[model samples]
Target: MDEQALIPDSQQGDLNAFNRLVLAYQDLAFNIAYRMLGDEARAEECTQEAFFSAYRHLGSYRGGSFKAWVLRMVTNACYDELRRRKRRPVIPLEPLNDTDEEIESPAWLASSDPSPEEVVHLKELDTAIDHCLSTLLPDFRSVVILVDVQNMEYEEVSSILKSPLGTIKSRLARARQKMRDCLQGFEELLPSEYRHEQEGK
Candidate 1:
Protein backbone atom coordinates (compact mmCIF):
# COMPACT_ATOMS: atom_id res chain seq x y z
CA MET A 1 0.00 0.00 0.00
CA ASP A 2 1.03 3.61 -0.57
CA GLU A 3 2.41 5.67 2.36
CA GLN A 4 -0.67 7.91 2.62
CA ALA A 5 -3.02 4.98 2.98
CA LEU A 6 -0.69 3.33 5.45
CA ILE A 7 -0.55 6.37 7.75
CA PRO A 8 -4.25 6.49 8.56
CA ASP A 9 -4.36 2.76 8.94
CA SER A 10 -1.36 2.90 11.21
CA GLN A 11 -3.01 5.66 13.21
CA GLN A 12 -5.93 3.37 13.75
CA GLY A 13 -3.49 0.91 15.39
CA ASP A 14 -2.21 -1.18 12.53
CA LEU A 15 1.13 -2.41 13.83
CA ASN A 16 2.22 -3.71 10.43
CA ALA A 17 1.81 -0.37 8.68
CA PHE A 18 3.40 1.52 11.56
CA ASN A 19 6.34 -0.85 11.45
CA ARG A 20 6.69 -0.19 7.76
CA LEU A 21 6.73 3.54 8.43
CA VAL A 22 9.37 3.00 11.07
CA LEU A 23 11.45 1.04 8.62
CA ALA A 24 11.26 3.85 6.10
CA TYR A 25 12.15 6.71 8.45
CA GLN A 26 14.16 5.26 11.32
CA ASP A 27 17.56 6.14 9.81
CA LEU A 28 16.47 9.66 8.86
CA ALA A 29 15.08 10.23 12.35
CA PHE A 30 18.11 8.79 14.11
CA ASN A 31 20.58 10.80 12.02
CA ILE A 32 18.75 14.01 12.83
CA ALA A 33 18.82 13.14 16.51
CA TYR A 34 22.52 12.29 16.37
CA ARG A 35 23.33 15.53 14.62
CA MET A 36 21.32 17.59 17.07
CA LEU A 37 22.48 15.94 20.25
CA GLY A 38 26.08 15.19 19.17
CA ASP A 39 26.14 12.01 21.23
CA GLU A 40 25.56 8.61 19.75
CA ALA A 41 24.04 7.04 22.86
CA ARG A 42 21.86 10.03 23.67
CA ALA A 43 20.79 10.28 20.06
CA GLU A 44 19.72 6.63 20.08
CA GLU A 45 17.71 7.19 23.22
CA CYS A 46 16.08 10.26 21.71
CA THR A 47 15.25 8.38 18.53
CA GLN A 48 13.55 5.58 20.47
CA GLU A 49 11.68 8.08 22.60
CA ALA A 50 10.60 10.04 19.55
CA PHE A 51 9.24 6.95 17.83
CA PHE A 52 7.29 5.92 20.93
CA SER A 53 5.96 9.44 21.35
CA ALA A 54 4.88 9.48 17.73
CA TYR A 55 3.12 6.16 18.12
CA ARG A 56 1.26 7.45 21.13
CA HIS A 57 0.26 10.61 19.33
CA LEU A 58 -0.41 9.03 15.96
CA GLY A 59 -4.11 9.82 16.17
CA SER A 60 -3.30 13.51 16.36
CA TYR A 61 -1.50 13.42 13.01
CA ARG A 62 -4.10 14.71 10.56
CA GLY A 63 -2.86 13.62 7.17
CA GLY A 64 -0.54 15.58 4.87
CA SER A 65 3.22 14.85 4.85
CA PHE A 66 3.79 12.03 7.31
CA LYS A 67 7.58 12.33 6.97
CA ALA A 68 7.47 15.96 7.96
CA TRP A 69 5.21 15.18 10.89
CA VAL A 70 7.52 12.45 12.17
CA LEU A 71 10.52 14.70 11.69
CA ARG A 72 8.85 17.38 13.79
CA MET A 73 8.37 14.80 16.48
CA VAL A 74 12.01 13.78 16.28
CA THR A 75 13.14 17.40 16.47
CA ASN A 76 10.92 17.99 19.47
CA ALA A 77 12.40 14.99 21.20
CA CYS A 78 15.90 16.32 20.53
CA TYR A 79 14.88 19.70 21.93
CA ASP A 80 13.54 18.07 25.03
CA GLU A 81 16.75 16.13 25.42
CA LEU A 82 18.73 19.36 25.18
CA ARG A 83 16.53 20.97 27.82
CA ARG A 84 16.96 18.02 30.13
CA ARG A 85 20.70 18.12 29.71
CA LYS A 86 20.70 21.81 30.54
CA ARG A 87 18.99 21.04 33.83
CA ARG A 88 21.64 18.45 34.72
CA PRO A 89 25.14 19.21 33.51
CA VAL A 90 27.53 16.51 32.31
CA ILE A 91 30.99 16.33 30.80
CA PRO A 92 30.79 17.89 27.33
CA LEU A 93 33.17 16.20 24.93
CA GLU A 94 33.34 12.64 23.71
CA PRO A 95 36.63 10.76 23.96
CA LEU A 96 38.28 10.22 20.59
CA ASN A 97 40.69 7.55 19.33
CA ASP A 98 43.37 7.87 16.68
CA THR A 99 41.35 5.81 14.22
CA ASP A 100 38.63 8.42 14.39
CA GLU A 101 40.88 10.73 12.37
CA GLU A 102 40.41 8.60 9.25
CA ILE A 103 38.61 10.54 6.56
CA GLU A 104 35.67 9.27 4.60
CA SER A 105 34.56 11.93 2.20
CA PRO A 106 30.95 12.50 1.33
CA ALA A 107 30.05 10.82 -1.94
CA TRP A 108 29.59 14.16 -3.66
CA LEU A 109 33.14 15.23 -2.74
CA ALA A 110 35.03 11.96 -2.89
CA SER A 111 38.29 11.74 -4.86
CA SER A 112 40.60 8.79 -5.65
CA ASP A 113 43.98 10.31 -4.73
CA PRO A 114 43.29 12.04 -1.41
CA SER A 115 46.45 12.12 0.79
CA PRO A 116 46.71 11.47 4.54
CA GLU A 117 47.40 15.17 5.19
CA GLU A 118 44.38 16.02 3.09
CA VAL A 119 42.30 13.50 5.08
CA VAL A 120 43.32 15.10 8.37
CA HIS A 121 42.63 18.57 7.05
CA LEU A 122 39.18 17.57 5.87
CA LYS A 123 38.50 15.94 9.24
CA GLU A 124 39.50 19.19 10.97
CA LEU A 125 37.11 21.05 8.70
CA ASP A 126 34.36 18.65 9.67
CA THR A 127 35.10 19.27 13.33
CA ALA A 128 35.02 23.02 12.75
CA ILE A 129 31.67 22.73 11.01
CA ASP A 130 30.28 20.74 13.93
CA HIS A 131 31.60 23.32 16.39
CA CYS A 132 30.01 26.15 14.43
CA LEU A 133 26.73 24.28 14.22
CA SER A 134 26.76 23.80 17.98
CA THR A 135 27.17 27.56 18.41
CA LEU A 136 23.94 28.33 16.57
CA LEU A 137 20.69 28.80 18.47
CA PRO A 138 18.54 25.70 18.30
CA ASP A 139 15.97 27.28 15.98
CA PHE A 140 18.62 28.43 13.53
CA ARG A 141 20.48 25.13 13.82
CA SER A 142 17.33 23.16 13.08
CA VAL A 143 16.74 25.10 9.87
CA VAL A 144 20.36 24.56 8.79
CA ILE A 145 20.30 20.87 9.59
CA LEU A 146 17.02 20.31 7.80
CA VAL A 147 17.85 22.36 4.72
CA ASP A 148 21.59 21.92 4.37
CA VAL A 149 22.58 18.67 6.02
CA GLN A 150 19.38 16.80 5.29
CA ASN A 151 18.96 18.34 1.84
CA MET A 152 15.35 19.40 2.36
CA GLU A 153 13.99 22.10 0.07
CA TYR A 154 12.85 25.46 1.40
CA GLU A 155 9.18 24.48 1.23
CA GLU A 156 9.75 21.21 3.10
CA VAL A 157 11.78 23.06 5.75
CA SER A 158 8.96 25.59 6.11
CA SER A 159 6.45 22.80 6.60
CA ILE A 160 8.70 20.96 9.03
CA LEU A 161 9.61 24.10 10.99
CA LYS A 162 6.07 25.47 10.76
CA SER A 163 7.50 28.83 9.77
CA PRO A 164 7.15 31.20 6.85
CA LEU A 165 9.19 30.41 3.75
CA GLY A 166 10.94 33.74 4.03
CA THR A 167 12.02 32.98 7.57
CA ILE A 168 13.44 29.67 6.50
CA LYS A 169 15.40 31.24 3.68
CA SER A 170 16.71 34.00 5.88
CA ARG A 171 17.76 31.63 8.63
CA LEU A 172 19.48 29.29 6.17
CA ALA A 173 21.33 32.15 4.53
CA ARG A 174 22.49 33.49 7.85
CA ALA A 175 23.53 30.04 9.04
CA ARG A 176 25.60 29.40 5.91
CA GLN A 177 27.25 32.79 6.22
CA LYS A 178 28.09 32.11 9.83
CA MET A 179 29.56 28.73 8.94
CA ARG A 180 31.66 30.31 6.21
CA ASP A 181 33.02 32.86 8.66
CA CYS A 182 33.79 30.13 11.19
CA LEU A 183 35.63 28.14 8.50
CA GLN A 184 37.70 31.15 7.44
CA GLY A 185 39.86 30.84 10.54
CA PHE A 186 41.08 27.47 9.29
CA GLU A 187 42.15 28.63 5.84
CA GLU A 188 45.81 28.03 6.61
CA LEU A 189 45.09 24.36 7.34
CA LEU A 190 43.03 23.77 4.20
CA PRO A 191 44.47 22.38 0.96
CA SER A 192 46.13 25.15 -1.04
CA GLU A 193 43.73 24.62 -3.92
CA TYR A 194 40.73 24.98 -1.58
CA ARG A 195 42.26 28.04 0.05
CA HIS A 196 42.85 29.68 -3.31
CA GLU A 197 39.35 28.86 -4.51
CA GLN A 198 37.80 30.25 -1.32
CA GLU A 199 39.96 33.36 -1.52
CA GLY A 200 38.89 33.92 -5.14
CA LYS A 201 35.24 33.56 -4.12
Candidate 2:
Protein backbone atom coordinates (compact mmCIF):
# COMPACT_ATOMS: atom_id res chain seq x y z
CA MET A 1 0.00 0.00 0.00
CA ASP A 2 1.01 3.65 -0.52
CA GLU A 3 2.33 5.87 2.30
CA GLN A 4 -0.90 7.86 2.58
CA ALA A 5 -2.74 4.61 3.14
CA LEU A 6 -0.03 3.46 5.48
CA ILE A 7 0.01 6.69 7.50
CA PRO A 8 -3.60 6.47 8.58
CA ASP A 9 -3.28 2.78 9.28
CA SER A 10 -0.24 3.53 11.37
CA GLN A 11 -2.05 6.33 13.16
CA GLN A 12 -4.90 3.96 13.97
CA GLY A 13 -2.55 1.70 15.95
CA ASP A 14 -1.57 -0.65 13.17
CA LEU A 15 1.90 -1.88 14.05
CA ASN A 16 2.31 -3.72 10.74
CA ALA A 17 1.66 -0.55 8.74
CA PHE A 18 4.17 1.33 10.85
CA ASN A 19 6.73 -1.43 10.41
CA ARG A 20 6.31 -1.11 6.65
CA LEU A 21 6.91 2.59 6.95
CA VAL A 22 9.97 1.90 9.07
CA LEU A 23 11.39 -0.43 6.44
CA ALA A 24 10.92 2.25 3.82
CA TYR A 25 12.56 5.06 5.85
CA GLN A 26 15.10 3.38 8.12
CA ASP A 27 18.06 3.94 5.79
CA LEU A 28 17.30 7.62 5.23
CA ALA A 29 16.83 8.15 8.94
CA PHE A 30 20.04 6.31 9.82
CA ASN A 31 22.05 8.21 7.22
CA ILE A 32 20.79 11.54 8.56
CA ALA A 33 21.79 10.42 12.04
CA TYR A 34 25.23 9.25 10.90
CA ARG A 35 25.95 12.48 9.04
CA MET A 36 24.88 14.56 12.02
CA LEU A 37 26.54 12.50 14.76
CA GLY A 38 29.48 10.96 12.79
CA ASP A 39 29.41 7.59 14.54
CA GLU A 40 27.71 4.38 13.39
CA ALA A 41 26.75 3.16 16.90
CA ARG A 42 25.29 6.48 18.03
CA ALA A 43 23.54 6.91 14.69
CA GLU A 44 21.90 3.52 15.13
CA GLU A 45 20.75 4.50 18.61
CA CYS A 46 19.32 7.82 17.39
CA THR A 47 17.58 6.11 14.48
CA GLN A 48 15.85 3.61 16.80
CA GLU A 49 14.88 6.39 19.19
CA ALA A 50 13.59 8.55 16.34
CA PHE A 51 11.41 5.73 15.01
CA PHE A 52 9.97 5.14 18.47
CA SER A 53 9.22 8.83 18.86
CA ALA A 54 7.67 8.97 15.39
CA TYR A 55 5.42 5.99 16.07
CA ARG A 56 4.25 7.59 19.30
CA HIS A 57 3.55 10.92 17.57
CA LEU A 58 2.19 9.48 14.33
CA GLY A 59 -1.23 10.85 15.17
CA SER A 60 0.09 14.40 15.20
CA TYR A 61 1.26 14.20 11.60
CA ARG A 62 -0.87 16.29 9.28
CA GLY A 63 -0.86 16.07 5.50
CA GLY A 64 2.64 16.82 4.19
CA SER A 65 5.83 15.05 3.11
CA PHE A 66 6.06 12.02 5.35
CA LYS A 67 9.72 11.62 4.45
CA ALA A 68 10.41 15.16 5.53
CA TRP A 69 8.54 14.64 8.76
CA VAL A 70 10.57 11.53 9.55
CA LEU A 71 13.78 13.31 8.70
CA ARG A 72 12.84 16.15 11.05
CA MET A 73 12.33 13.62 13.82
CA VAL A 74 15.75 12.05 13.23
CA THR A 75 17.37 15.48 13.12
CA ASN A 76 15.79 16.39 16.43
CA ALA A 77 17.12 13.13 17.86
CA CYS A 78 20.62 14.03 16.67
CA TYR A 79 20.30 17.42 18.35
CA ASP A 80 19.30 15.74 21.60
CA GLU A 81 22.22 13.31 21.31
CA LEU A 82 24.58 16.22 20.76
CA ARG A 83 23.29 17.93 23.87
CA ARG A 84 23.71 14.77 25.89
CA ARG A 85 27.27 14.43 24.58
CA LYS A 86 28.03 17.91 25.90
CA ARG A 87 26.73 17.14 29.40
CA ARG A 88 28.75 13.93 29.63
CA PRO A 89 31.70 13.44 27.34
CA VAL A 90 33.24 10.00 26.76
CA ILE A 91 36.80 9.42 25.56
CA PRO A 92 37.50 6.82 22.94
CA LEU A 93 40.39 4.45 23.60
CA GLU A 94 42.11 2.88 20.63
CA PRO A 95 44.36 -0.14 21.05
CA LEU A 96 48.10 0.53 20.88
CA ASN A 97 50.84 -1.73 19.54
CA ASP A 98 54.11 -2.63 21.24
CA THR A 99 55.67 0.73 20.35
CA ASP A 100 52.70 2.57 21.85
CA GLU A 101 51.54 3.58 18.38
CA GLU A 102 47.86 3.35 17.40
CA ILE A 103 47.10 0.43 15.08
CA GLU A 104 46.48 1.75 11.56
CA SER A 105 44.15 -1.06 10.53
CA PRO A 106 42.01 -1.86 13.54
CA ALA A 107 39.42 -4.54 12.81
CA TRP A 108 36.56 -2.41 14.15
CA LEU A 109 37.01 0.40 11.62
CA ALA A 110 37.50 -1.88 8.61
CA SER A 111 35.12 -2.06 5.69
CA SER A 112 33.88 -5.39 4.36
CA ASP A 113 36.21 -6.83 1.67
CA PRO A 114 36.96 -3.63 -0.20
CA SER A 115 40.04 -3.59 -2.45
CA PRO A 116 42.99 -2.10 -0.62
CA GLU A 117 43.17 0.88 -2.96
CA GLU A 118 39.44 1.45 -2.75
CA VAL A 119 39.56 1.29 1.03
CA VAL A 120 42.32 3.90 1.17
CA HIS A 121 40.50 6.20 -1.22
CA LEU A 122 37.21 5.82 0.65
CA LYS A 123 38.84 6.49 3.99
CA GLU A 124 40.63 9.62 2.73
CA LEU A 125 37.51 11.06 1.12
CA ASP A 126 35.31 10.23 4.09
CA THR A 127 37.76 11.80 6.50
CA ALA A 128 38.04 14.95 4.36
CA ILE A 129 34.28 15.40 4.03
CA ASP A 130 33.62 14.58 7.68
CA HIS A 131 36.25 17.08 8.80
CA CYS A 132 34.72 19.81 6.64
CA LEU A 133 31.21 19.01 7.84
CA SER A 134 32.36 19.06 11.47
CA THR A 135 33.48 22.67 11.09
CA LEU A 136 30.03 23.93 10.11
CA LEU A 137 27.50 25.31 12.61
CA PRO A 138 24.68 22.84 13.28
CA ASP A 139 22.03 24.84 11.39
CA PHE A 140 24.30 25.30 8.39
CA ARG A 141 25.42 21.68 8.57
CA SER A 142 21.85 20.37 8.64
CA VAL A 143 20.83 22.32 5.56
CA VAL A 144 23.86 21.14 3.60
CA ILE A 145 23.50 17.54 4.73
CA LEU A 146 19.80 17.47 3.87
CA VAL A 147 20.31 19.09 0.47
CA ASP A 148 23.63 17.75 -0.78
CA VAL A 149 24.27 14.58 1.15
CA GLN A 150 20.68 13.33 1.46
CA ASN A 151 19.63 14.67 -1.97
CA MET A 152 16.62 16.49 -0.52
CA GLU A 153 14.95 19.41 -2.33
CA TYR A 154 14.83 22.90 -0.95
CA GLU A 155 11.10 22.65 -0.32
CA GLU A 156 11.49 19.40 1.66
CA VAL A 157 14.43 20.90 3.56
CA SER A 158 12.41 24.01 4.40
CA SER A 159 9.61 21.82 5.70
CA ILE A 160 11.99 19.64 7.72
CA LEU A 161 13.79 22.63 9.23
CA LYS A 162 10.62 24.74 9.64
CA SER A 163 12.47 27.66 8.11
CA PRO A 164 11.25 30.09 5.48
CA LEU A 165 12.28 29.60 1.84
CA GLY A 166 14.42 32.72 1.87
CA THR A 167 16.19 31.57 5.01
CA ILE A 168 16.78 28.16 3.52
CA LYS A 169 18.22 29.64 0.37
CA SER A 170 20.56 31.94 2.25
CA ARG A 171 21.72 29.27 4.66
CA LEU A 172 22.25 26.74 1.88
CA ALA A 173 24.30 29.21 -0.11
CA ARG A 174 26.48 30.05 2.88
CA ALA A 175 26.85 26.38 3.77
CA ARG A 176 27.91 25.45 0.24
CA GLN A 177 30.45 28.25 0.24
CA LYS A 178 31.85 27.09 3.54
CA MET A 179 32.05 23.50 2.35
CA ARG A 180 33.77 24.52 -0.87
CA ASP A 181 36.35 26.54 1.05
CA CYS A 182 36.96 23.76 3.51
CA LEU A 183 37.23 21.11 0.80
CA GLN A 184 39.80 23.04 -1.17
CA GLY A 185 42.42 22.20 1.43
CA PHE A 186 42.01 18.53 0.53
CA GLU A 187 41.95 18.96 -3.24
CA GLU A 188 44.62 16.35 -3.92
CA LEU A 189 42.71 13.73 -1.95
CA LEU A 190 39.50 14.38 -3.88
CA PRO A 191 38.48 12.39 -6.93
CA SER A 192 39.99 13.63 -10.17
CA GLU A 193 36.69 15.08 -11.40
CA TYR A 194 36.21 17.02 -8.20
CA ARG A 195 39.86 18.06 -8.20
CA HIS A 196 39.48 19.33 -11.78
CA GLU A 197 36.34 21.24 -10.81
CA GLN A 198 38.17 22.83 -7.90
CA GLU A 199 41.11 23.72 -10.12
CA GLY A 200 38.77 25.34 -12.64
CA LYS A 201 37.35 27.51 -9.89
Evaluated with lDDT, which candidate comes out highest?
Answer: 2
Clashes of 1: 0
lDDT of 1 at 72: 90
Put down candidate 2 lDDT per residue, 34-141, tens digits, no spaces: 888888999999999999999989989998899889988999999899889878987557657679999676664343333344344545877767767876778888
Error of 1 at 71 (Å): 0.1
TM-score of each: 0.78, 0.82
Q: How high a TM-score does candidate 2 get?
A: 0.82
What is the alpha-carbon lDDT of model 2 when measured against the actual structure?
0.84
**Model 2: per-residue Cα lDDT at residue 63:** 80
> How well does model 1 score by local distance difference test?
0.80
| After superposition, candidate 2 runs with Cα above 4 Å error | 92-123, 197-201
For model 2, where is the 10-residue window of minimal lDDT? 109-118
Error of 2 at 16 (Å): 0.3
The positional error of residue 172 in candidate 1, measured at the CA in angstroms, is 1.1
With a 3 Å backbone cut-off (N, CA, C), the pairs that clash in candidate 1 are none
